[model samples]
Target: MTKELLLAAFIISVGLCVAGAGTHFYQWRLRQQAMLRYDGATVFASMGNLVMSFFCGPYIMLQMGWSQEGGASVNMGSALLSALVAFGWAFLTGLLIVGLYVAVRS
Candidate 1:
């Protein structure tokens, strides 16, 4: 693959992993604060924030005209699609991590 593609993939992977870790940490914090077992509402809130941040990061990048080619290009349609994809990936990653944690705890 091209260097640009590799770089893009690496960045996106890192973003998703960070988002998942953030969700896990947030859930843990909530559980600690409440001094109770993990619940659906807490998980949902954590996941929602995680996904929002994930998309927001990329959205901001797009807004600032940050492109893989290192040039300023405003493509609203493409940026919106990218934001949606990032959000979905982050949401899925968070859900998978939470599911695994619940599975292990059970």
Candidate 2:
């Protein structure tokens, strides 16, 4: 049961990370074409935050699991909540990156 939960969390984290990375990369491409000198580090920093969130979200969710007599189960709400929180954190980090980009650009 623990193994199943771990597997599920890992899969979820990977999905989130992939989605986040793709989005960041797309943004980078757009910026690269529009601006003469865009900081590549912004995209890398956002990706790093996404990676951190991938690990963080699952770890938080895993802690919310409860053990029972026959099997172990985790609350669906908790999992979603953790994912939301992690995504929010990453989003905020992305925003910060954007702000930094703007600051440096000017």
Candidate 3:
């Protein structure tokens, strides 16, 4: 069970990181074409937060598990909740990136 959980965590984190890197790279391309703009720090910070989130996600899910009520099986809700929280955090970081882009372009 523990090994399965560790595997899930590793897969989820790495998957999110890969997806984030791709998204950021696409955004960078758009900025290059003048479709968007942000100072380097903002763009880098946004990307950095994704990396940080990738590392932090599983710890958070497992932490929530401690208080959850799934006796013989994992509570899918906790996983979903953790995913939402993590993505919410990432969304907030994205907002900062958007604000920076607007600040520069406007």
Winning model by TM-score = 1
Clashes of each: 0, 0, 0
TM-score, predicted candidate 1 vs. hidden true structure: 0.36
Q: Point out the higher-scoring one by TM-score: 1 or 3.
A: 1
Compared with the true structure, all predictions reach lDDT values of 0.52, 0.49, 0.52
Quote each prediction's TM-score: 0.36, 0.33, 0.34
Q: Which residue segments of model 3 deviate by more than 4 Å?
A: 1-19, 22-74
Residues 1-106, model 1: lDDT tens digits: 6997665555556556665455456557656322112234687866655554553343333333324433555566666776676655645554555556679999
Put down candidate 2 lDDT per residue, 4-103, tens digits, no spaces.
7675555555545544565456457655311113234689866655554443333333333332223466566666676676555444454445556679
When summed lDDT is taken over every stretch of 10 residues in candidate 2, the lowest stretch is 31-40
Give the lDDT of residue 22 in candidate 1. Answer: 55
lDDT of 3 by residue, 22-106 (tens): 4556457655321122235687866655554443443443345445574766678776776677555444544445556679999
- Candidates 1 and 2: which is better by lDDT? 1
